[model samples]
Target: MILALYNRQLVEKRSDEAIFNELKERSNYIENDIQSKLLEKNKISLTNIFELTGKDLGISFTIYDNTLQIFNSMDQYYKAGIFAERINPQVYYNLNYLSFREYTIKENIEEYVFNSFYKKISVDNKNYILAVNDAFNKVRLTFSTSDLDVLLFGIYLLAALIIILISTFLADKISSPIRRLTKATMSVAQGDLNVSLDNQEKGELKDLLDGFNLMTNELKRNQSELAELEREAAWKEMAKQVAHEIKNPLTPMKLSIQQLIAAFRDKNKRFDEIFEKVSPTILNQIESLNSIASEFSRFAKMPSYKIEEVDLANVATDVINLFTDEAVDIQLEINDQLPKISADNSQVRRLLINLIRNSIQAGASKIKLLINHENNFCNLVIEDNGKGIAPEITDKIFEQNFTTKTSGMGLGLKLAKRFLDGIGGDIQLIESSKPGATFKVTFPISQKNSFI
Candidate 1:
């Protein structure tokens, strides 16, 4: 509005020369009036024209003719009347000739200058030019950019925090079940065949868990079937042994009775002597048959165990004392500091007695019993310097009715192994080579109730 008013006033004049004369006259009048006021206040200079224009209109102004006057809002004043050629001769010429150009200007303020918008206005007949500027626009733009940067930073920070929280929650949810499955798999590998997993998860993991549970159940069922088949085979083998033992004595008894009948028929004088010999033979064979029957009965009807905490070394010592009259040399090596094991007293004693009887029957001259603690177990090692079991039949040594002895039932070692198994203990043939046989019995330190 101010620029339009000034342009109209300048355009109403007659020519370019008249326009310049009129502007100079107005400038002198304003300067003289300001100087008159300063004189009254004992001042000698004219008041700053830029300060007056900015206070009234919030802008800076400049005028160019043959001379130049530049004023700014900062209360600066510059004049280059005829000496303008000494200041920047090309700059004054461009400002005078470029009457319609409007562009940005850079001028020093304090120690630096910033860009500000300016427009050039032509007076009547292109005799003079006026420049108008607004410098504070750049200050508003700087403040706006700073505020935008702060807002963008806050938004990015919030997004990153939210992503971290979500990632943590998802990781826990996914890994927790996998950890449980890993623990369950370890339990299965360690021989807990009954271990299984829950099928409570969703998607592919749920299918995998269900499949694992089914596999465990199938494994358990297969194991049970195999155990049943082994039991049947053992029973059939025992029956065959019984038949063979009974046939051995029956054949000799039949021969002796037939010879006595023949002698009686002949009516010889030595018939009485032959009858006496035959009578004792028949009696001995009957006793042998009775012994076989008794052994089978005992094997078939194993006694139930009475579980209790007992010192295995003491039990071994008692078994050793029982064989004092025997010709074989028996020695006991025991660690007295060993922890008490949970077992039935009578069963342990019987198990030791059977092993010792086996060594004596095998023609062992020396037997050693070692008792100690190792790896959370109580170990009882029985080593014998006897004719070791043949490699061909080593695996069958503990099978029911399987024996290498001439006048013995094979139930001894089988019954011993069964007894140990019933009490949560295990027996293994550590070595069975010539000149010696070693057997190891291990029992867990802590026992729970178990039965066969």
Candidate 2:
């Protein structure tokens, strides 16, 4: 019984596949015929195919200008009726057997020949059409209604059983690998990088699984590298601050030692000469101490912000005015319609001052401060005509106490950057031209509080 059921299901599947294949071939044939007819010099109408060819050949067919409608009719039992109408309402054909004249179709026009009747033709009740394929053309001598009922009932039950079995088999075949893959993915997500899913049965799923595993491994490696990079950046920032803080005190100490050596060499210089030398050195040291104290104080203090809408162009004008009398020429290329930004006025002023000073020190003859807006952020670009910073040290320039100058505390740019950060702004040394460095600062549109 099981074997029979399996066979029934297999047969039903084969029949379905065959039906689809036949319909596809028929559609292709119709398309080719239509194209051929179009190429012919004669006036060829597809409608005539039904009237002339189908009727003459005793084959049921309906021709329509639309391919889909014609194909749909062929799959339905309505093809013959539609064919009759298309050909002519009077033309009709019927299939008859030798012994039993079971069904009769009456026609107004005699367009069909008796055409030796076959007794064992297979009928497809699903489509309400006869399968005229060469493999199933054997004519049945007779059909008994009782026998037919029994045969149909058993065939239907068997086909149902077969389909259930095939479905179960396919489900298991497809789901087993998928279940395995899901488990492996869960393990990976839970931090198990060593999990393996090497199902190499050679199909699309296998390739996808392989690629997924490869991607996971690459991501893991990148994550490790990123962690290392972050650690390095933190250390660099810390070292910068420490060096700058230490150098402040060290500069004055060096000057004091130089004065002591000068006093030792001049015996006749008298108390005034020695006192004068020591006094200037002491004052220098005190100044250095003050600078160091102030810088550290600023670093340690948390700023209070007072954010307000301020025009950037006016701010640039004020900052540039500080260097007006200097030998260097400063230019403001502020956008005429630059938007007012919600930022701390004091912090913006300090940031601009530091940046401008850096530009002047960088040997810029003409510093251009360009203000603009981009992607909802306010952009400030400071360009100089001084010697540009070396490409190698560009990234480290923001570090505390890291400077290329012989004088002054190196905390100017670093403090400016931190101040900007406090106000939810970012600063970057964008590029340097032949003259000097270009620094770009971006401030977010929405500032929660003003900078103090």
Candidate 3:
């Protein structure tokens, strides 16, 4: 539609110039013909000259000498004899008045138009109709062109506005999704795991959202597990120290009761032998009580390490040997290049023993101890081929009083971890379940001097 409008405007503007040029040529032709005929006939009067020129030249003619005016209409084609005879002389007179309004004479016969204006002039005693058409045609052309230019400009402006609006709408539509995704990403980065995208577009962006969701979920889960593990570790350390402190006073009481029972067992004290027999029984009970109290006291004491150079492999070997009497099968793999660690030898040995014993108690048939040096630290890993712990219970293994063993005070691994911690080391339940458990003990090089 716009193209058509522009074409129409162009044609309208150019048409005026075309018509004016055509009319100027036609007027020149007419003037030349009139002069040529007048010179040929040597006529002086306008009225007589018109009749002669009209007859000889085969074109309708017009001549005016003030009151005696003459005029004739010629078809656009000016086909000489054919159009001259059919020409309306009165219509030509009306054309002279219409011409004053800047009009063009066009006909289907010529498929063309011409624009000009008419005026009367005196040559000698006769008057002639002189067409002064240049400025007249120019003015008509100018007005026509101006109107066309206005229409074309209006269309261009409208098109520009439409294009601008369409571009703005599309830009917002495309950018909105990206903006939403950006905000969602920032929220996720800031630890909001529940952020979701509303876009259902099936493309790479949707895939990206899926990936982002997965990453956030994993991070949240890991963070939760880490917090829980820290709490368990803290509680385990506190409980272990408490138990260790509480076990100290019961040892001497158990011995005193046993000595009193033995004294009553003599023959001179037969009647007292009865009391002596009861005394030994009471002493046995006291000893048992004393042992229990001692275990608790030991469980509650916080480990204080004296750092020294110590061989982690020798400590691991001794821990394994400590459990050699058990029915469980054990294997030890210690790295020969294991660096001397700076830690309390006694605490490290206890850490290893606790882990090995825990694995054996978990119904593990074959226990594997791997000791190695890594990252300027000694790493002791005790793995058992028993049933692995349930995922739910594995995290709670380091908690005080949280135990899988019926025989333990539930402070073995707990205390071991505390002692390891006191020596700038850590004991971790690396893996576990009904299948088996693996405990890792890492002792730093700074504590190596105490171990030695």
Candidate 4:
């Protein structure tokens, strides 16, 4: 619309012939100026009228007759006859006669013809058509689709960033509780039945949170009931052990007294011999009962651990040396640098003695005591080539009053474990079903001054 309005204004201001003559005169002046400048510079080169025109008004002017004369930032000339052959047949036919036409063609021609429209011009009684073409590149500033494309891309990128940020925030908001529940589930799996979750939301997540809380509550209740049942069972087992142990001594004591009463009633001469024999037997039974009572009392009133830096290797050596004359072959393997551990020296020695004696009682021929330091812990591994503990009874080996031996009060391993636990150490049966039972005791290495 702007171009048509501009053409109308130009047509109104000057007649077709006058506008044509003016353009021809301007072209002549441009050529003359270029020739003069070239002569002044002592060079033979055509002036780039296109560049000159673009720099000024950004318009290209062309005149066509038997040849085409084109002028723009890049000045070039072409023969109309040759250019016509390369152009579309219809466009060439339209432009072929435009230069010689006597009147204007109002309609704009096709794109191949430089967006040209025909107008009649007379100079010295000869007529020609003045062609005008729009050259946007001649202009310094212009809008293009590529600029719009860049703008749209920036807008889309901003939109995508906003969406991503919003999505991330929503995801965190939605999954935060689930993540907490997942962590709580992990704690539950690790035996933390006391865990509970908060229900702060008002949707499905809230329902999930409530469910999780209920589940944990149920687990806590079940764990409490189970612990109570276990305590009761343990007490019952202890009662049975106590009754059985007391019965062993009581039956013999009662029998001896009955025999003494019977001998007194018989009025027999051998009564004194019987009394002597029965008296010793009664005393031995009483001593056995006393020993059982002492064991129970010691277990009930276990001493608190007096934590001090004690050389573990020294304690192990002392225990091993005590059994030098025993039938078992005991070997102590001490590392070059054994760390002292924080424990009661007497308790450590007692633990070792009990373990060694148990191995000997198990008919072990070879006992290996390995002492070493690893990862800030003093490790004492005792291995015995004894009849390995049966798999069924291995779990009960550290339970108080649980024993396979007939002579013992059955608190050796249990007391050893309790004593170690008191000093922040632990004892474990590494492999009981192997050729030899292996026991591993670990104590945190002491950093204080050592009582080696």
Residue lDDT tens for model 4, 2-35:
5445644554444434444544444445444444
Clashes of 2: 18
Q: Estimate each model's TM-score.
A: 0.45, 0.33, 0.34, 0.46
Model 1 lDDT tens row, 1-452: 35444544454332333433433343444334434444464433223543553454443445445454444334333332322212234444555566434333444457764343333433223433343332332222222334544655676678779889999988877886677677656545544454446567899889878888888778767866786798799799999999999999999899999999999899978899998888999999999999999999988767577777787877787667655545679999886588888777666776777787677767799999989898778999999998988899989988988988653446667977887787768999999878889999887675554443
lDDT to native, each model: 0.65, 0.59, 0.61, 0.66
Error of 3 at 409 (Å): 31
Give a tens-digit lDDT track for model 3, residues 1-452.
67856787678757756765655555555666666666676745655665555555444434433334344433232345433333234435654555432234443236543344444434444445544333223333434555666877897889899999999998886676677667656545433344445546567767876776677667767866786798699779867765664444345555655655556455345556555555566566567667776776665464456777888777666556544445678898877577778877666655665566556556688988887878877787888887778888766777777886543346566776666776668877776656777777887875324321
Clashes of each: 0, 18, 46, 4
Can you rank all candidates by TM-score, best first?
A: 4, 1, 3, 2
Off by over 4 Å in 4: 1-58, 63-130, 136-143, 199-202, 262-274, 294-443, 446-452
Worst 10 residues of 3 by lDDT: 100-109
Tens-place lDDT digits, model 2, residues 76-190 = 4444452232322112122222333112222233563221111111211111111122121222223433444578688878998999999999998877667767665654543
Give lDDT for model 1: 0.65
State the weakest 10-residue window (summed lDDT) of model 1: 79-88
Let me know the TM-score candidate 3 reaches against the reference structure: 0.34
